[model samples]
Target: MNRRHARRQGMIALALTGAMIALAGCAPEPDVQPTPTPTDSAVVPYDGPVVFVGDELESFLLTPAEVAEAIPEATGVMNASAVLEQVSDGGGTAAVPAICDALFAEQSLGSVGARVTRWMTPSDPEYGQGRVEVLQFADEQQARDRMDQLLQAAADCGQFTKEAPVTFDAEILDEVDGVRAFAGTLLDIDGGYDWRVFQAYAAVGNVVVMLNQPFTGDRTYDAQAAASLLQQRAGDARDALVADLTENPPVPEEQPVTDAAQPWSEWAIGVDGVGPVLLGDAVDVAVAAAGGTATPPTFDRGPWIVENPEATASMLIQQAEDAETVWYVTVGTRRGESAETPQDGAALPALGDVRVGMPVSEAFAALPGGTIVDVASSGEDYYAVTTREGRLFRFDTEGDAADGTAIIIGITVEDATQRASLRFG
Candidate 1:
C-alpha cells in the first residue's frame, strides 16, 4: 500500500480503540495488587538500655554449690527454651524478691538473660563471710526465685531472735562486695535488720546484678518489713524492665573462636625474632658433659627448668657463648617465674640440670614482644599441631599433646606443661 493509505488505516484503528476504552469506563474492575507477607526483618530488634554488669539484684534460694550443680547434663546441648524448661523443673513455689507478679512467673514472663555486675559478702553482724553471688538468669522467674529465697532466709533467720531494746541508725554503703550491710549492722548492735535492705527489680533482661550480702547476728528490724520492701522493689523493677524490653531487646554479641595454643604464639614469641635457634627437634647434648647427671628431665604438666647445679654450669657457658635464650618449662608451678626470669634456685642449665620449675606459658607471655621468629615446618607429629614462638611443639603422641608435654631443647620456658620437657640448647 502507499504511505498515505497506511496512515489513514492506522488513524482508523486508533479511533476504534479509544471508543472501546470510553465504553469500558462505565464497567467495574477487580483489585490488582496482592496482599504483602511479613518478614523477620520487618520485626525490629528489642530496644532496651545496655545493662551494666552490676545493675540487678540476685537473691539465691539455693547454695552456691547447689545452684552451680543444678544445670542438667543436657544443658550443654539445649536451646534457651530447653534450658529454661530444665531450670523450672525443680524450682517450686519459690517467689522472686526482685520482680513483680506480672513478670516473675516463668510461664507468663518467658526467659531473660543478663551479665554479672558485682559480687559481695554481707556484713550483717550475725553472719560471717556469707557468700552471695549475683548472676543474670536467662529467665525472670529464675531471678525472682533466687531473690525470694535470699529474702526468705534472711527473714527466717531474723525471726529466731527476741526483741531487744537496742536501736541504732542504719547506714547503706554502695560497696560492691556487700561490706556496707555488714558495716552498717555493726555500727548499731541494736538495729540489726534495719541496718540493711536488699531489693531487686528488672531494668532490662540483659541488665547486670549484684550478689553479696552476709547475715549478721543482730536481727533488730522487722523481717517482714524487709521482705515487703524487697517485694515492692522487685515489682517496680519488673514493670520497668518489661517496658524497656518491649521497646528494646538485647542483641547477641559476636564471639570469636580462637586457637587456644596459637592465641599468643605469634605476637608473644615466634614472629618477633624471639629465637635464633629452631629448637623443635634439633637439640643435642651430653648429660655429664652438660654438667648434670646423665639423665633426661622428667616431663609433666608443671613448669620445667634446670634446677641441678651440674646442669647450670653447662647451660650458662653455652648461653654465654651463643648468646641464645634458654628455657625451663613446667605445667604445675605457680606464677611470678618464667623461662626468661627463673627464680635464682629454679633456673639451671638445660644440659644436665635437675628439673627446676618454669612457668612455660608465662615465659612465652613474658618474652620481650619482638624476639621469637616462627619457622614453618612439621614437627614429629602425624596430625596438625600449633606452633608457638617459632617452635613447633609435638610429643610422641596426641595424649602428650593434649596434656601439653612436648620435650625439646633450646626452648625457652613457655608454661608448666612445656617446662617439664626440657632439652639442652
Candidate 2:
C-alpha cells in the first residue's frame, strides 16, 4: 500500500482499538452526576421538542452564514451520518471492520441528532481544516453519560500500533469546567507528514457539543489554539441553548405525528455531461461521462483509478477479473494547493446533473417521483435530504428558508455504508 493509504488505515485502527477498550467497560464507573460546581447554575430543563429537526440547531449553534463569514470558501455542510461515514483518503482494508464495530455500536451517539460543518483553506485544503459537530441528546444526563464513556475509552487505550508501522498516541487533556478534552496524533514511520487532532466534548443540558480540529501537514500544530477554540465554541453553544429555552418556552406536550403521505417525484440519476449510468458501468464509459478522456483500464487485479485531470475529479471503478461486470464505482474531488485544475463552474463528476455545486432545491425539483423521506439541517438553513430510494443529498443554503436557494454539496447513491463492498469479489 502507498504511504498515504497506510497512514489512514493505521489511524483508523488505533481509534477503533481505543474505542473497543473504552466500550469494553475496562474502567470503573464513576458517579454519573458531575461534581457540584459554579456551572451548575447554567443548566436549564429542556422543554423543547425531543425529536429534533436539524434546523432547530440555529437556536443554539453557529449558522451556516456565520461559519462562512468566519471562514470564507467553506464548502457545504454535512449531517451526523455523513460525518461518521467520512473515511480517510486512502481506502484501507483493515480499518473498515474496526470503524464499523465502534462507530456504529448501539451507544455511539447514533440515537441522538447531530451535524458537522467543515472549513478548509483554498490554498491548503488538506491540512488547515477544522470541523464542528453538535449532538443533541434526549437530556443532559445522557450526554454526560456519553462523555464519561469516551473519557474512559481514551484512558484505557493510550498508545497502539497498526500495520505499515503506524503509531498512534492519545492523551487526555485537562478538563475545563465540567467538560473533557483530548488530543491524538498519528505518525507514519515511512511517510513525511503526520496527522494531529484535538477534540473537546461538553454536555449542556440536552445539547452535547464536540469540536474537532485536525491538521495534516509538516508544521507543528497549535494544541492550545485548538483547545481554546473548542472551549469558546462549546461555551457559546451552551449559553445559546439556555437563552433559547428561557426566551421561547415550549409547550410541555408531545408533538403530534402526521399521517399524511408526502408527494413523491421520479429522479433521473446521471451527471449533466455523463448521461444516466448504473453502478457497474465500464471504466471508460464512466470516465467519458465525467468529462474526461478515456484510457485503457490497467488491471493489477484491483480497482482501476480513473482521473479527469482538467475537471479535478477522479473515480475508483472496482470489478473482478473473472467477471465482466463492475462491482461498484466511487468518485471524489481533489482539493489542495497542488490539486487538479477545473474549468470555471464545472460540476463535480460524481453524479452528473445531480453533482455537487447544483442548487439543492433545483435538484429536488427535477425529480418528479422523489419524496423527501427525511431532512436535517446544521444552521444557515442547510439541509441533508434522504429520498425513499435510499439516495442521500446535502444542501447548503444562502438565506432564509422561505427565500434561500439550497445548493447541493454532497450526494450518495444507494447504501453509503456498503459502497465499498457492494458486491462480492
Candidate 3:
C-alpha cells in the first residue's frame, strides 16, 4: 500500500459507537459461509466474511467503565445495539458516499470482529450523544489498508444525502496518542451551506476507534469545540482499550475436571431439547429447566438473559414477539481437561460431554460433518458443528490449532433464521 503525504499540518479538535458493545447480540443462529481456500491478495480477504474466529476481538472492545471515563457528564449508558446505530449511517433517498455514510463510525470496515461502547450526554447540547468503538481486522496489514480507505473517503467525499442533502469537508488532524485523527463538517444544502453537523475519526494499528457527538437539537454548532471534545475522547478511548488488552489478556479457565455423576452428560443434544428444555419452550419453562433466573433484556429486541442462582453461569434465550415461544438457547463455559462441573450448584452438563475449554478438534470428532467456518488460529477462533439430526452447535474458543488446543469460551444451540445480522460482513 502507498502512503499519502499531503497534509494541512495543524491539529483539529475530535468526536463516535453501535447497538450493543462487545459480543452483545442476542440474535441466535449466525448464517455462516463455507471456508474458502485463503489467497494472498489483501483486496480479497476470503470468499466470505471471516467471523466468530477472533475471541479476543471482543475483549479488545472498550468497556462501560471506559466509556464513562470518556464521557464524565453522560446521563446514562446505552446498550450494545446503540453502538451499531452509532456506526451505521447510510440511510436516505440517495446513494451516500461510503465515507460520508460512516461519518461517525465505519460498521462496514470489513474486519474479522468488532466491539463498541456508547453513551448519552444531555449536558452538552451541541454534541448530543457520544460513542467509542474498536474494530479488529485479521492482521495489521488489513487494518492499515482499511484505515487508508477511510482517509481516502475523508479526502475525496464532499457531498452526501441525509434527510436533507449536505456537503461535507474534512481536515486531517494531528495524530494523538499514536492514533491518526480527522475532523469533518457537514453543511446543509438548503441552509445556505452552513455548518450543521460535526464528527471525528481515529485510526490506530490493527484497529480503528471512532467517536461521534451528534447534535441533539437546534443549537449553535461550533466546529472547533466539537473537534476538540471528540479528539480528547477518542484519544482517551484508544488509550483505555490498549491498556486493558495489554494488562489483562484473557485467562482460560483451567479448573479441575473430575468425571462425576452429572445429569446432562447422559443427555444428547438433538433438534429437540437437551433434556426437559425443548425448542419453542416459553421463557419461564426454559429458565425452570436450566434452574436459572431470568434477567431483563438490554436492548429493545434483546434476548432474555437467564442467570444461575449462584450467578456462576448464564443462558441467553431468544424468542420472537409471541411472549416467549419459538426459542433459541445459548450457554457456554471454558472446557477443562475432563468433564467437570464448573460451579458447585450450577451443574451445567457438557451437552453430551462436549464443553468449552477443550480442543476444537475434540468437538469436531464428537460431532462429525461439522464444518470449520473460519481458519483456526491462536488468539480466538470458532467452529460450527451440525449434527445428523439437524442440530446446530457453534463454539467460540481460545488457544491455537498448531497445538490442537483451542479452548471454547462460548457456545450456542440455535435454529436457522433469515433476519439474522452478520457480525463480520
lDDT of every predicted structure (CA atoms): 0.27, 0.42, 0.49
Report residue 415 deviation for candidate 1 (angstroms).
21
Candidates 1 and 3, the one with greater TM-score: 3
Model 2, runs deviating above 4 Å: 1-112, 122-128, 138-142, 164-177, 188-203, 206-208, 252-425
Model 2 per-residue lDDT tens digits across residues 316-406: 4445345544544434321111123332224334333455555656654544322222222223333343321223333333333223264
Estimate the overall C-alpha local distance difference test score of candidate 3.
Answer: 0.49
Off by over 4 Å in 1: 1-152, 155-226, 242-425
Best by TM-score: 2
The candidate with the higher TM-score, 2 or 3, is: 2
- Comparison by lDDT, 1 against 3, better one: 3
Q: In candidate 3, which residue ranges exceed 4 Å CA deviation?
A: 1-73, 77-99, 102-109, 123-129, 158-164, 175-178, 187-197, 220-425
63 Cα displacement, candidate 3 (Å): 10
Instruction: Estimate, for each residue in 1-425, the C-alpha lDDT of model 3 and write its tens digit.
Output: 11121111111111012333222223334455688997765442222211122233343344566554444465566654311222233343432554554443344334433445567777766656666555544444555565665666677667766556666677776666655667566556463434355555555555555555455334333444434554565456545554554454433222224222335333344455444555667756765676556665666656666555555655566675444563456565323211122432224445556764567667767754333333312233455543312245666666442234766665666543212222211
Model 2 TM-score on a 0 to 1 scale: 0.38
Q: What value of lDDT does candidate 2 attain over all alpha carbons?
A: 0.42
